[model samples]
Target: MTPQRRVTLADIAAACGLSKATVSMVLRDNPQVHPNTRARVRAELDRQGYVYHRGAASLRRAGAVNAVALVVNDLANPFFAEFAAGVDAALAEAGHVLLLGSTGESVERQHAVLASLVEHDPAALILSPAEHSSAARLRRVLGARLPVLLFNRRLDGDGPGDWDYLALDNRAGARLATEHLLARGHRAIAFFGGHRDSSSCSERREGYRDALAAAGITPDPAWLIECAPTRQEAARQTPALFVRDPAPTAAVCYNDAVALGLMAGLAACGRRAGADFAVVGFDDIAESAFATPALTTIATEPRARGLQAARLVLARLRGELPASPHTTIAPVALQVRASTAAAPDSPLQSSVQARGPAA
Candidate 1:
């Protein structure tokens, strides 16, 4: 008996009852090949263990990995989860996939994630950086090396580089929340937040103060609380505000998580968010709408932001447009639910003192 020979292109073509030229075209990914024929050719290639040298290389060069890294400060955060879901939707629509990694709010961990992603050599990366990293360090290291699109958080001094960015106009959004509370006759408004060093947090705080200054209300140095980034921590520290001699009538939270936590803390002290004190949150996460008394919040357009960021990274990868170093969306409408209503009977008048805490 004749010994079996190694499978070749011709062998695949013969086995599939197709011509050598057709097989060759299929291997080359020539678009002229009919879909059925291409599929048949690929099937046969797999069966025969046939490898197309140039075709594989071309696929790699063209980003056939169809991957982009999504690095976030914390994956456990609901806001990030929503943002990641949006990113996944956009990527799926575009025939791509996302590689997710969480930094857990650590610069060293962020560095490690980026480094690990580099090993995969993804087409691009979307990042919400940890607070400790400097723009210069980011630029010096990851900026020049790959196309990075900043999402959610903006680093200080990163104007426009080869990278891209899409961020919320946090300052303007915070102002809207603050002014809304002020309009409801809540003069003593407090700002509760995460890290002060975070650009988004600082910008929100700035907006809060700007609104007060514009309204001729003196900024209270005691009104701002730099609390923890998590919901539990926000709950732990929020009671301090209630204990103050003149508790703020309304509080602007960093995000829905903090807002809900603050509400919990207030409840523990016999105060309710919508019934005893007004509360406004940012990010407008889905749960914010479901929270007891439903939260009033500044909508950040997370899905749109994620889609835009994906587009920016794809465009940069394709060399279609110059990297837009910075991009921001203005605050749109505020979602005023029971949490923000001054009273159940009136839409315009909020029940400041009756603000009920989240259940």
Candidate 2:
């Protein structure tokens, strides 16, 4: 049995009375192609049943690619979902498809995913690395040719020195959240969720510490809660914050998931967020607003950051970004909502009031 040959761009161009380059431009959705010509080419394409296999096409055309690889640490988180959507939008706008992967915050899984994607010969890779991902290890898995963008989480130690970096202002965002909690008359504040080793988590924790130090308050070790940066883990670890005699009156959560989870945990413990306790979250994921108390959070605009990441990688591939590893740290802003309020009447709040806000 003879199989039908796949339709080629040349074949489409010949039938449409246009050059292959013009037909290719039309296929790419390039805006410069005249609308009439684009319509003509598209009609011919439909008639011929032309299926654009971009990956296979890349193999045949040297130094040509129209696909990007993206690996995020945890797809379960809504933040990554929104970020991926942004990446998709930017890639589609540039006529590229995204090859997505998740690592579940496991370094071993990340290694496997990157190795598999490399086989596809994608033009670039944008990664929100799992915790403990190291540049030396990544370099071993992914050789130097592939343009890389490290998003959100930084690779451990020295990072990919030559890769593009697009990250949220983690330290600043956490600082803003902590400062807001302080302004609400809460002194015994806890930095909640997330392990302290990951760079993003550490930076946020640092910001929390900075705000506390600035207020002349020495945070108890028990008050700095550590969890898996997930709702389940955050809820499980909630009791750790209260083991001390005077427990923190408020908390700066690692992200929206943790904050929402903490709120739930607080409910289980017979406490209310806006009335009896205060909570501030980071990475204002969509669900933050509708949480029981309408969470107050730091808005990192994950989708916009995703767009910025995709565009940056595309620029690197096109020689638009500087050769010396382009780095972009997007800023964050606080969104105040119902989750936070004046600290509940407690001995800790009174002691703090008596001393006044840390000078």
RMSD of each: 5.2, 4.7
Residue 342 in candidate 2, Cα distance off native in Å: 0.6
For model 1, how does the per-residue alpha-carbon lDDT over 1-359 read when each residue is reduced to its tens digit? 85877667779889889898899889768999999989988988998777655334536466455678899877678888888888888888888878889989888888888878766767788989898676887665464667787776777666554456677888888998888887666788889967888888998899988999999988677788988767899889987786677767788898888999988888888877787788899988888889887889988867777777777777777778754554645455577776764533345453443243222
Q: How do the residues 1-359 of candidate 2 rate in per-residue lDDT, one tens digit apiece?
A: 85999899889999988899899889879999999999999999999999887666567785567789999977778999999999999999998889999999889999999999998888899999988988899998999788889898777787357788898999999999898888777899999999899889999999999999999998888888888888988888888888897989899999999998898888888877767788889999999988878888999998998899999988888888777987788999988887876776643454322222222
Model 2 residue 278 CA deviation in Å:
0.6
Runs in model 1 lying further than 4 Å from the true structure: 1-24, 27-65, 140-143, 156-162, 323-326, 341-359
Whole-model alpha-carbon lDDT for candidate 1: 0.78
Best by TM-score: 2
Q: Stretches of candidate 2 above 4 Å error?
A: 1-5, 8-46, 53-56, 346-359
My TM-score estimates for the predictions, one after another, are 0.84, 0.86
Alpha-carbon lDDT, every model: 0.78, 0.86
Report the poorest 10 consecutive residues by lDDT, candidate 2. Answer: 350-359
